[model samples]
Target: MVKIRLKKFGAAKRPCYRIVVQDSRKPRDGTTIEEIGTYQPVTQEGENQFTVNEERAKYWISVGAQPTETVKKLFSKKNLNKK
Candidate 1:
């Protein structure tokens, strides 16, 4: 199955993540089909901690790409701002 998920990056204490489209069976940081955004968990909320292309994300989801729990929460936060 294809999925939309975070790929861990950055140094040990300062981890960052790249939200990407990849196969579910692949390793967490192995390879990605497309990069859609980023997230930094340690940063304050709304302090440039998350960045996602909503359009692409929606499209991928529509095509059956499952997002991780964290990614789902981020999208919800983004949508709340549009309301």
Candidate 2:
């Protein structure tokens, strides 16, 4: 099954993540089908926490991609409610 999930990256102490579409059985940072957004923790004040292409996200959902638990929570936090 195709899954929308996070791909981790960045240095040892600093972390960044790319929200991507990939097969559910693959590793978290393995081959991806598409990139949908990004997430960065606030190491400093007032940094952009996350960004997502809403239209693309909706398109992927329509095509039957399922979001991971974390991704689903992110969507809910952004009021992007999905089934």
Query: Highest lDDT: which candidate?
Result: 2
List per-prediction Cα lDDT, in the order shown: 0.86, 0.88
Clashing pairs in 2: none
9-74 per-residue lDDT for model 1 (tens digits)? 999899999999999999999989999999888886558888888888878888888888877788
Q: Positional deviation of 25 in candidate 2, in angstroms?
A: 1.7
lDDT of 2 by residue, 13-67 (tens): 8999999989999998889999989988746787788999998888888889999
Error of 2 at 8 (Å): 0.3
TM-score (C-alpha) between model 1 and the true structure? 0.86
RMSD of 1: 3.3
